[model samples]
Target: MNRTARLYALVEELRAAAPRPVTVAALAARFEVSTRTVQRDLQALMAARIPVRAVPGRGGGWSIDPGMTLPPIHLTAGEASALTTALAAVDAATPYADAARSAAQKIEAAMAGPAAAAARELARRIVTLPRPGDSAIRTAVERALAEGTVLLLSYRDAAGHESDRAVEPAGLLAADGRWYLIAWCRTRRAGRGFRLDRITAAAPTGERAQPHDLAELLSGSAAAGAVRPTALGPLPVAIA
Candidate 1:
């Protein structure tokens, strides 16, 4: 199970045994993960404001207040299939790709057995082409964007000239059947769009990115018209 699904399952497990603590070791065993990993997951749940409590001492463990949790979701076969189709469209080049898959799995897992089977069959009828890109580079770019950090990139331009660059990830753009990482290039001292396929290597620098207006930068670019203002305009002001 991916971490996202595991987190969701962890909540369900606690909710099912509400008011009674389930030990960390037991949770680790149930999830087939290390106790340390369970601890981290618990911390993440807490960070997300989940109503989980860590009780102390013997016979103590983790528990959630069921009253505070949402009721089970029930999706029709067609609805579930619709979700699958949408999530499947999130390719390796997109951010949160893993999370999207995890969410789809959770949705299926939540469905009634027959409904889930029908959903699967319906999803199979729709075909999609595989996206081409390096998973490692995609992961690095996703992390840089998620954490608001600087990224180190090894890039080969159209001229086949290779160079190393440190950039602040601003956003991603999909144009002309390709994905581009829109970033503030430190080397060029300006905003630039680097094609994902041309990125030979990518790594997070672990440094927080300096603040910049991504929409303003994109508006000034030659490809500005190719990108819709609504794409960057609808973003929460705090995010911008």
Candidate 2:
């Protein structure tokens, strides 16, 4: 791998193999570089203020600070329940499911004392069911909203009509065991909510989602009217 990739890989390796120092010779051999090069790379990482440390002696090596790897998250018992509760409502096979699971793990890992026990106990009692194909639309709509990009979508509506349209996806809502994409439909010249299951494909347009339209969606007044029982209000993004 190139230096940049190697540097990042080194960090991952240190983080994963942490508490157990990875010897310089082992790192060099793993990266297919000389000992000197590995040493310089480690120094560079340290100089850049990455939480790396070198242990001494014959068995000693390099290690990353475990505390440095902790994710920044803290949740009240109610907050934790609400989050895991919402996530449980979504399908486990969705594209973002693993991401949600990992975030949940990190959130729990960051907790300690009584809070952690409560979270773990509550998690045992709460279960959310997910629609199998809801992941596609969720991933697409979320990306479009986050990047402020237009999306080219192949959508099948309620009547089973299939059509391709370029849409500016402004926001997303999950309601009644379903997912919806709220977007400015180029074909209809209006904002519409398309069901997640109906989307066959979604591709980014590399164009900016119009500011006014995005603002209109973010304003809640316009987006709320886009779909029934739609709660398009901005919610806190916990871990993911």
Candidate 3:
């Protein structure tokens, strides 16, 4: 590898070793370069908005701040193919408005030269069939999941009656080209799956629900044809 590439790899190694700080001297010794070269690499990382902090004095070195996002990976042909396939599946299942574009941008930024161009070209040639979903419903589900809020939804039942219901948003599932919210219902006192497209209105109650075991909730017994109703437990009552 060239000096620049070798330095970049060293930076990656240091970041992976965090939260343990790595000294410049150690990096120089590992790469058979001078401390000045290591310092230059650290500067490059800082310029790219990596949260690198330098500690002065003996036994001190550099560490990356936790929670800083890492740059995307540079993908080989095989890796690029795998990533595109997985992304395509996600895109088809959820059809998020921004996710595919954001992924493409990240992939392009991570790769270089012909590899980058080929990845982009392959992505363009690939297509995924999307399931129908109300973007608003999907957005509301995402919000509830992130905020841990209960949702008040206006839904159309199988009989086509539009009624309001309160549900504890447990999680989202995609099955057979449809999106379903697996939640605990306040009125029914049981878990239920609601179709995203049938949801006419969704409003967050601003009250967070108790934690639910996601793994058990999504296990084999909870599969599409399963009749198990109470997978985790009774959903907690609203906190007053």
**What is candidate 3's lDDT per residue for 59-151, written digit by digit as tens?**
789987656655445557768655654564565337354456456554555567777677667767777666565667777777888788899
For residues 1-240, what per-residue lDDT tens digits would candidate 2 score against the true structure?
Answer: 767668767888888888899999999999999999999999988875678999998789999987776433446777776666555444543546655775576456545677768777777787655456655556766677778999999998888899999988766666566666778889998777777778888877679978435446535543454443324466768996
| Every candidate's lDDT | 0.84, 0.73, 0.71
- Model 1, 149-232: lDDT tens digits are 999999999999999999998888778877788999999999999999899999898999987666766877876766554534
Off by over 4 Å in 2: 1-89, 92-98, 134-137, 212-240
TM-score of each model, paired residue for residue? 0.67, 0.56, 0.58
Tell me the lDDT of model 3 at 142. 77
Model 2 clashing residue pairs (backbone): 88-128, 91-130
> What's the CA error at residue 70 for candidate 3, in Å?
3.4
Tell me model 2's lDDT, rounded to 2 decimals.
0.73
Candidate 1 — which residues are off by over 4 angstroms? 1-10, 13-60, 63-77, 226-240
lDDT score at residue 80, model 3, on the 0-100 scale = 69
- Of 1 and 2, the candidate ahead on lDDT is 1
